[model samples]
Target: MSRRRSKILVVSALAVLLLAWEGAVVLTGAQASWPFPSGIIRSGFAITADGTLLVALAGSLQRVITGFLVGALVGIPTGIAMGLLPWVNLAMRPVTESLRSIAPIAWIPLAILWLGVQGNAALFVVAYAAVFPFILNAAQAARAVDRNHLRAARALGAGPGLILRAVVVPSTLPTIFTAARIALAIAWSSIIAAELALGVKIESGGRSVAGLGQLMVATLYVKRDVNALVFGMLVIGLVSFLIDAVLRRLRDTLLPWARR
Candidate 1:
């Protein structure tokens, strides 16, 4: 669909959803206790005013960013090696496949047991979730590098390192970027899961580490705060959507040649 039509549809759908939600709340007698639209807004404002939401957001972002960076740093190079070297690919494929087959959630209990329910545990989980996708995509992209290009570089007396930097890396740049973006999304999801399963314990002056996932669980299940829960959820959705959009835009702009 055209961009304008798509935007209009999205807006219309959102408006309808809001109206339906408001109507349901009003008719169910729940509105008398906790209204819809306004209730969510007020709850969001209250959490923001108290700095709880900001704290949680910051903590969550930190964990995801740290884990993503660490994972990419290791995963990209390992993937490149696997793609370029037959020996490495043969050796690592079985192990990589086996480990990746295990769900990220499965690592939670072990992460908690080994690292405890803290910042490190959350980071480890995020890294685990992010790494495999990055490795798989990067390896495939690198492996698909044109053999003709490699031959041309070699005929020019270019060394292996030079050919990699000049040809293989360039050719695979777009795919690597796409993989990194996917890894970031996975890391974000993993961090949230970790936060819910194993709360972060960021030691500040006296405040402990907090996260949106933990706040969500506390508000929804423990405190029975529906408005706050919804607000937290909306924040997560909006932020993730925004980040992905930006990444896509960046990929298109920076790797225009890849489109050809």
Candidate 2:
């Protein structure tokens, strides 16, 4: 139905669920172990007041943006080349296919070994997670470009660069943007997973990383703070939702003709 109605329904459902949870905790005397929704909100407010939430969010966003940009820079051009040139596709397909088959999470250990437990390890994982979608979507989009358009451009004496600029780029950009959205989601997940893994592996002498994942891990394991852990999880979900909404808005604004 309407967007407003859908949002109201979602808010109502969440309120019902939270109230039920709060009632259950009150009835069962489990507030010590299981926090109520109010407790979680209070914890969130405490963290925000102390600047913890903002710092963690900044660290996570920084890594995600850097890694995703690097992935896009590398993947989009490679994908476009593969789609445009059969020989390039033939040469790279086997490697790209093999690499993509490995989950980004699976690369955490290798990243740790190569880059250590620092931010670079998380960046590597995020880039790995972000790149494949870009490559796959860009390639598919390029391949799906109307051959007639290319032919028409060529018939008008367009060279390779001219045809690419006039024909291929416009045709492929919508899908590239779609790929960017998918890659961004993946990058967020990858960075969190990478950060969590690194946090767990950190030694007393090793450098401590800061992110929502690390905050959750610390709260859950070190401090035994369930409220903070839940707050961090909620923050992650909210941030992801907001980022996706912004990306969708950008796509709509820039590529109105490509709206699905």
Which segments of candidate 2 are over 4 A away from where they belong?
Answer: 1-14, 203-206
Error of 2 at 16 (Å): 3.7
* Regions more than 4 Å wrong, model 1: 1-16, 31-35, 200-209
Task: Write one digit per residue (lDDT tens) for candidate 1, span 51-116.
Answer: 999998998999899999988888898898899889999999999999999878678878877986
Q: What C-alpha lDDT values do all the predictions have?
A: 0.84, 0.88
Candidate 1 has a TM-score of 0.88
Residue-wise lDDT of candidate 2 within 1-260, one digit each (tens)? 99999999999999999899999997999988998888888888998999977888899899999999999999999999999889999999999999999989888888888987767889999999999999998888889989999998899899999988888999999999999999999899888898888777763445564887777777777778778888888888887898899999999999999999
Location of the lowest summed lDDT over 10 successive residues in candidate 1: 199-208
lDDT of 2: 0.88
Clash pairs (backbone) in predicted model 2:
none
Write out the backbone clash pairs for model 1.
Answer: 202-209
